[model samples]
Target: MQMTVSEVLARFVSETDFSALNNDNVVAAKTTISDCIGCTVAGSATEVGRIVRRVAQSSGGEGKATIIGGVSGASAQAAALVNGAAAHALDYDDILWSLYGHPSVTVLSATLAVAETEGASGRDLIQAYAIGVEIIGKLGRAVNPQHYEHGWHATASIGVIGAAAACAKLMRLTEKQIAMALGIAASQASGVRRNFGTMTKPLHAGNAARAGVFSAELARDGFTSSLVAFEGEFGWARTLNARTVPDSDGLQVMLGKPWELTEPGIVLKRYPSCGGTHCALDAMIAIKDQHNLKLEEIERIDCDASPFAHKVLLYPRPVSGLEGKFSMEFCLAVAAIEGSAALRHFDEAWINDPRVQALLPRISFNPRADLEPAISADAVPAEVTVFARGQAFSQKVLVPSGDPRNPMSTADRRAKFMDCADGILETDVAEKLFNDWERLDQVAQLDELLSPLRPQN
Candidate 1:
């Protein structure tokens, strides 16, 4: 039934009832929202955020939603664009390993902007967010991660579908409308890996998020798009993928799997660099702690990652901060020299440091096949070694700290929230946000939660 976008989207949304959601679903929704809020605030204070904010405001469009951490509010679409990019500015927003991508940054950035403008309650916001995250996760899994290998940005491509589903669900559209929204989103889906390590990479995420919202709104107003935008012979998979892609029914397999944030799930980063580099950082930090080797004593460092991991990291020379985050060379250099990829490691002078630059050549990568990556392999794996003062030390990190394997405790999440909210909000205000999100269904007004985000006098 070659239905319109709104018709299709509404149909799918009607099938997703929040009250019936399980505990994991609820928790995923809550943490992702809180995580995005934290990342957005942290990103806003960065130089990249400052620069992008000015550009967004200067190109002013409709004043629909506020761009958190920006110079001024812009239209919903514009705000989503800037806010989404900023949330990931530190390359530390959060990661959903299930999807092998970043979701909350894209889905929530647009969803939050729209929810605030639509006056939706916190409960409404979380429901929409879960739908978005779920949809993106399913879509990414369906694609079998080939798209990423083929150089398409999953966060942007799959994220567009998620945002559309979210917007359609939040707007209370019908199953048909929801399906159509997916169609509309398919048309707008795009993002490339070539832009990795650049502002444009995150901007791609912002674009996908904002575009999905726009697609949904248009669909709601009787807009139309291809009915089989996802499955048609000439549809998304065929056009975007060079090899065989997952069948449409593949989407149903994990469409509503137990919430992805709970177990064997999303990896909330404790560091601000590429997830690929985490195992190496994990190894290096432990070595530094055990031996207390001065940076001068370290002759060289070595990291072993799967071929795919090497492709993502292991860049020989990095000229920018974005590149620095993914550079095994750069990240290894910092971890050995500075002990962490904290904000301080990203300073301009530090990025170009003579000592770090000198060590770059000594840093090399060992590429291994994913042969039984772990006790039970989970996609990514690595082993790192260090040679310092005639002693060779090595460690293997099957999963990083934030992985569901080595999950962060709730208290850890709370501490992170507190850190992210420090300068912008007091403990009481942040506490309110953490507590209220759970009881959002009973909340009347959205202002209580949104209050902390407003610019102070």
Candidate 2:
């Protein structure tokens, strides 16, 4: 009998072994998990994170799952909701190019919630996360560009399914149940780019994590959904469109041959803003440095980027910090003035500063017509031109920092972890936790490290 997409996904989830993952992929998963933990911890301190945590805690049911920096032991779904929101609250979570969304938060938030509830070992967490990455990466190849072009936020729409797969694997669900879980997730998948610069964006991540856990739990208890929910007539593919959908044959051929985590892998974010703005921001910073630009000397700046960048960086004159993140003009203008787009730099004061406001009109996006037909998301080529001191300085960045080709170093990653952990943890505790994460797969219990994430009574 021929199987459906969900069946194939379910079997892959049920059959893949931890031993199938090589050392490098395992290390990548560990780093992603660690980074997510830091992001979640930092996010828990945010206004949005606090609001969600309060709601979760007020729900009045409790389990063993950790809520990052909140009190320990919320129910698994509640923990997933809070931690997932926190992980993405700062827009600092790791990203996967193929997936075209934030991958780590969805996977880790759901897996850890389930792991804690089951007292699952670290190896189980690692294995489950690896499978989750594979699912999202493969599906990204199949559904995105078209799906993304249509304005679906793959982070939530695709991520919910990926999170469900991870949780199902960790829970040791049967193959049939896994298929049902994915079908259930299919109905729940939804988010859009219109909410990019608001609390709703991170909330999308949280919703995916929560729905993923709910889907798997429901399926495990014999809740039924279509086995072919992914490729059926009324399923995800046709709903998306007939012309653009997952390439089933392509995905099956590539499943684990070259693990997604090892090849194109997740990119760790260096800035606390939309990934769409990174390349241009990097170019503008480089140009500013090379020209020794002064605020007074600058005349105007010009930028050209991938058309997708144009679509994402929609805020031309942002009035708020969140809106500023999706504005290339604002990001570049700020980088030109501040030399860096650090976590502290994104605030109401920065948005309203006269220097930033003045620089906004000076920088403009010019979409190159030549590259329009051939643009792809992975290679977001950007050009920055600065007319300052009567000289034109130009720089182009084909690959932004933190991309696998131009990867963040171990020291850089650690520094980022420390930066995010600043208010949440003591320096010593933060350092120790990072070290522990390096050996996470070898640990006997997942809680030893996660327990520290709870607020001290």
Q: Using TM-score, give the best candidate's number.
A: 2
The C-alpha local distance difference test score for the whole of candidate 2 amounts to 0.85
lDDT of 1: 0.74
TM-score of each: 0.91, 0.97
lDDT per residue as tens, model 1, 223-255: 877776776778887777723454444444445
Off by over 4 Å in 2: 247-249, 369-376
Residue ranges of candidate 1 with Cα displaced over 4 Å: 1-10, 62-64, 71-74, 242-244, 371-379, 418-443
lDDT of 2 by residue, 44-138 (tens): 99988999999989987788888887877688899999999999998988888788888988888999999989998899999988898889878
Task: Give per-residue lDDT, candidate 1, residue 285.
Answer: 86
